[model samples]
Target: MATVAGVAVEGGHWIGGERVSSPTTFDDVSPIDEKVIAEISRGGEREARAAVEAAGKAFPSWSRTSREERARLLHAIADGVEKRLDQLAIVETTDNGALLRSHLRGVMPRVAHNFRFFADWLLTLGHEDFETRGHRNHVSWDPAGVCALITPWNAPLMLATWKIAPALAAGNTVVLKPAEWTPLTASLLADITAQAGLPDGVFNVVQGYGAEAGAALVADPGVRRVSFTGSVPTARHISTAAAANLTPLSLELGGKSPLLVFADSDLDLAVDLAVEQYDNAGQVCLSAVRLLVEESVAEEFTARFVAKASALNQGDPRDLATDIGPQIHRRQFERIDGFVQRARAEGATALIGGGPNTDLGGLYYRPTLFTGVAAGSEIVNEEVFGPVLTLQTFRTEEQAVEMANSTRFGLAATLATGSEERAARVSERLVAGTVWVNCFFVRDLKAPFGGSRQSGVGREGGDWSFDFYCDLKNTVTAPWEK
Candidate 1:
């Protein structure tokens, strides 16, 4: 078995529309193949604070921009993103493990689509006003000053855009911080914004570890809103930091999301949709990691799922044919491998793979699935955040829901059933933020996306995102002329 390894490097930062250097530098590597990709920098506290201050300075003008004008800028950003699809995809894949072709060709198109969708929504939203009493009181949309955006490296730019597009369209200035593991895409986004001719200080990026740049941004008193996507522990830390300032926050945290596959579902379609659960090598926060299948179909489903998972090509993320890729870094690879090891010690049986590919030489792990995980085991209750899925059986819908909500996390769930009414009942009752009926990761930018419990607070996407970034203030006019 070869060990997969890569360098851990600094990819710099972008603040006030300027590509700035990180105060400290590190090496970045691929977890699958152990390749050196870039020299990353540890962002400075001074820089992070400066970025937030810049965003605060820009917020007034940005918040006051006409809805039509904001939409135009967002639409222009979409156009620029469209033009750089390949480059963005390549940069995204290099910084993260997402497949180049799929992300560039598949995921990015969706991000662009999301951009246009929100841009149009921007125009539709700011025009509406809620007036109460004879004194005309109009509620107008405005930006949350100095929104602090923190992104993980898993999907890099795709997830970043999910926040950036809407925040910009909603007329908020932003200071973004990319995960230390993958700062390349965020660094490049500075150029992307430049191409879009975004105003100075409207958007910024800072690069460093969560403890440094990220922690500083969240705690900055000048920052009025904070949006973060990462692990549960990190979310908790950010929550604590934000609480000090009563800063409005949005956290799209980790999940041990469930997939309830009833016996009535088509096996073929179920298997196909199951792919998304493990796509990106099972790194997605909203991904379904705890699979609950009816015992009757468990045998068949497990067999096929194991074969497909074990057979996936694990290689360069730039390769379209490669289905699975390396882990993000050395520490993460060890963490995932350690989790699988602990699961085995706790008596869970690996039906397919639960080990690293010693052939890769550093950070790669096999896309693995575990069966026989006891209800109380780590595999059953924890967010693995790797290419590992733990599955168990249930005899009834009620049992499935109970098992689904068994974990402390509740980010999203996928209910696979033939009955629309049954799916609805389960969907309504599931403890997750987003429920997929007979599918997984089926998202529309117009919908609210977040969690129900320990998963997160508030929501992202649609007009709700606008609400998270801004508080509505009522303006009163004494029965005046129109």
Candidate 2:
């Protein structure tokens, strides 16, 4: 274990309810100041295999547990998470460089909610049963056994629990391989779950890079199902590895989502949503980074949007006043800088924040807004995963929809319009899986949440989550009055 800035890091894998260490370790660097925060256990194929085997051994007993028992345990887990809310929030902010205010207010709460929601949802879950021609048919959802969950760095606990809660509630053992950059919180979560009285091997965490532990976890034949939230290219690699065993996968990949602002929209509200692209420094997959405004109000919207974005405070995430924080690491910082530089070279005009916030130093990037962006250009179509926004104009509703659906990615979209009819009509046509009308990033745990097209493969929320974590079976009976 190592300590930095009063935060202690447990640099080991949590396997079968115990801490397992590796001979080799890797430095866990904080993007806040580019300092080595901890040295984490460097898990490889062997560790991944051990974790999976532990989960496999626990599956039969866990899968056989009553739904009531599972629900009770999940509630306990949620309670445990709530108890450590402040500590978890601060640790996550330190690890990932996301604003502590945001984590404390929303992200940490949502994490606990993920467990509670799934726990209660599991209790109320009802399967389909029908009778036709005096014959009975029943549909049952059974735990699928060992589940492999690979989560990303951004919003680590929230996103990881989005998959873990449902997987556990559905009575499947989970082997989680959190992103190496932000592995601390996941390690902490393992301890929390254990304290919550979860059975050994029911939930496990392996800390390492994606290619090593992540690849091994996905490629393991013992893994009955896989849920991954990350980039599209990595999804493809996981797809290839899982294809070998014909294992089912639920992928929540990258997005170049669009936000369409109509002329009738409230100018102030529209600006607020547009500026939200910089939330968590724009690492959000569901963020509408591509701003498509009606030509009638393009000038007004762009002016207000740029103003709000430019005013965003980029500083230490622990500060309550900060709106934006550093990129996860130097590599991500360089990646964002590259995108801005290329956009500049390609003739796009930056209305605000063209480069790094050198005043703040470290990995902090300015909230950037680019106009005069060419259609189908690299900046317009690619997922920058940074605090960068690109603006474009559309002449009519048709053009707006066309521009919104133009990209290969379609994870989510935001539409702002005063007309209720137009909101309904436009939302129906958006290619993304989830469309927010007159709002941004407002989510309901019961709603089906995932992506479409290149953005992702399947949905997960409410019963949709169980569909991935469990195997469905149909039981039919012949007429009793034959």
Candidate 3:
């Protein structure tokens, strides 16, 4: 497997069914080393205008197509993604520090399933109203024209497809700007999309920074909506831009999610679930930042949790033996380390694996677990985009819920309890978009995933995602049959 730091790519921008070299360009470096893996084209203001015009042109015809017809197109896309699974996977692995064999396999299946899932969903959405039993009330769905989908670096391809696939299924033309850090996979997605015979300008990718091409795309008057997944600060900026045009927007922002362990919860099950929540070195937006444990099991849980976290081998993401890898960059590495240092100075215990892994050449951080994390510390409050979990003990279930809801982010929360009632209770009290009971990160294509508060507005995935990317138009006949 080619390491992300070493993979060589012939960089260019994919626009309107063609890989065109841009006048403007930027270098994409692997976070592992400062080596320039590829010098990708950075779309300028002209390119952004062209992309918006193309997307706008495609929207009219694409939007009016029947849902069944749209579903067929999506199915073809899914098939195309499957056929080029190996190629796409390798590209994805090289672009992002995802495991080659494991990450590739999971994502291909996911990409394939995404198309089929959305296709099935699109098929079920009809123009006729089922709710109006005797009356002649009809419903219609129109594509939000020229949607500018700005996706993040962490899960670029998957997150882009999360919007692109559904937006396409619902007949919205897309001008996608992939994150500067991970551009290859999304660029390859443009290839597969073209291969699927998706209409020209219906799907497009422009690789550039958030401040340049990304801002241009977001602020484009031609774009009717903007869907973004990244930092909260970025989302706020996008929201401001979108508001200027009064364009609809879907924002999936940051998360400092929590996992509450009730006294009745099985410690073994909780530990098992914790591994995944903090996986990818806890770079996940849904990474359980706070581990809220009841006083009874706090010490016991900490021992097991520390042991499991410490045992994880941090190395190159390409290695199958590696459970975790370095952060995306040295900057992120320093930021995470700084947070750990501040916590320790604030009198918090570095329970285990609190520092860097000296053995790794890349920017590797240990899976840190911090105890005595007071609410005031940086580690306790801020989103440390690394493998760090702040432990907080609660004497009662109510206290657990209180601390869990303390964060401004309400993206996702988990409750591990023996009794179904306790699980339901905590799940209800916890203010989050998704509450996992017993299971963690059990994401099905059918489940809606997103946040409630500062985590950002709206949901993605499931049937609701179809609605998110499109607009609704309802027609009424005054109790008269058509």
Candidate 4:
């Protein structure tokens, strides 16, 4: 068997259920060792057009597929992913350096679950019919033609499935563009879907840089809907390109999500929840990057939070014991470190680590903590996208909510309080798309997930996702009296 690091994995574009070559190719380098592990086909506008055209060709028949047929195919995909979970986990760990244990336990399972969730949920869809004087109205859903799915590198396979499964389940053909930084598992997924018997041209992938393939995929007139999960800047660009053709979009963008800890709450639990920022090395868009503590317990909470954060084990992702791993790439590592240094220069005191851990090797950064982060400072406002947390204190519940709502990102937030009334009140006051009280990162497939404001545009789970991928249509019949 070929090991993840040693295998010379080579992938080309999967167009119309067949592998196609590109004139140029790029190397998939492992972030853990900064070594080339695979060679990937470099697609551009030409490839994007081919993929979109192929999806468009497939759309008519695919959209006509029965709900039961789609559901069965989705279930088959889930089973395929389950069978290959261990292999995919290792490939992802090698590709992006997310901890192997976390990838296997947390991320890869979700890849299968996403497909299963959508497959099962499709059966429960509810439609309504209306009766009027001499007329009857029936409502139905129709696939919105070809869709473009662009996913980021942080949790590539899981996030990709989050979009792909629902799109397919809703009967939309897709042209997926995985992030340039991580394409191995995505390539693997195309093969899995093929093995699962997804029809030709129904699902396609074009692997290349965002500037080349990503831009073309979104801008293509053939793509009727676009779903993207990445940075705010990239979303802005995609938003512009997509707007020209009036393509509908589902954007799951960045977050500077906040965690509020109250004096009446358990400080130890709060600390443990806040430490989740270091998960995936804080590359997650919904990671609680900001901490807002009640003034009554601010000092004590900060002390415990810093202590626990300082103790997290950071090293090789292959090690099951390693709690954290390297940042995705050298540029990301340096960008995060630059943010920390700039924050320090702006008078924010680093309560713990503030620089890269060269001793740990290969683009690793020490999990940094900061206090005295001024409101509207670069560090507090902008996403560091690393294992860094900034602390702020508020005296009143109103103040905590205000601070949490201050960022352009309204992705998600968490609060801890003893009073149920307070939890209810704070949860309502917060401007985030999802608010967690006394817990962190708790998610239900039934709950719609997305952000408000600049964080994102549309929801992506449950019926919301089903709706996003299809256009709701209504038909009316009138008696011959007219």
Which candidate number maximizes lDDT? 2
Superior candidate under lDDT, 1 versus 2: 2
TM-score for each candidate, following the candidate numbering: 0.93, 0.98, 0.95, 0.97
lDDT of each: 0.80, 0.92, 0.80, 0.90
Candidate achieving higher lDDT, 2 or 4: 2
User: RMSD per prediction, one decimal?
Assistant: 3.6, 1.2, 2.4, 1.7
Candidate 1, number of clashes: 36
- How high a TM-score does candidate 2 get? 0.98
Error of 2 at 346 (Å): 0.9
Q: Is candidate 3 or candidate 4 better by lDDT?
A: 4
Residue-level lDDT of model 1, residues 1-482, one tens digit each, is 11112322225567776657755677666544557677776786899888987888788888888888878878888888798777777666776777877886678887677678888987777544555666666787666678889988888878888988888887788888887777776666677677887888999988787898899999999988889988778988999999999998898888888888899988767766676677887888888888899989989987777766667787778778888777788788888999999989988888877898777656678877888889978878888789888889999888988899888888888878888889888988889888888767778888999987888888887779888877767677787676
Evaluate model 4: give its lDDT.
0.90
lDDT of 2 by residue, 1-482 (tens): 86645666588999999999999999888999999889999999999999999999999999999999999999898899899888889999999999999999999999999999999999888776899787799988899999999999999999999999999999999999999899989988998999989999999999999999999999999999999999999999999999999999999999999999999999899999889889999889999999999998998888787777767788999999999999998999999999999999999998999899989888999988999999999999999999999999999999999999999998999999999999998999999999998888889999999999999999999999998898998888997763
Point out the worst 10-residue segment of candidate 2 by lDDT: 1-10
Off by over 4 Å in 3: 1-10, 127-135, 478-482
Q: In model 1, what is the error at residue 362, expressed in angstroms?
A: 3.0
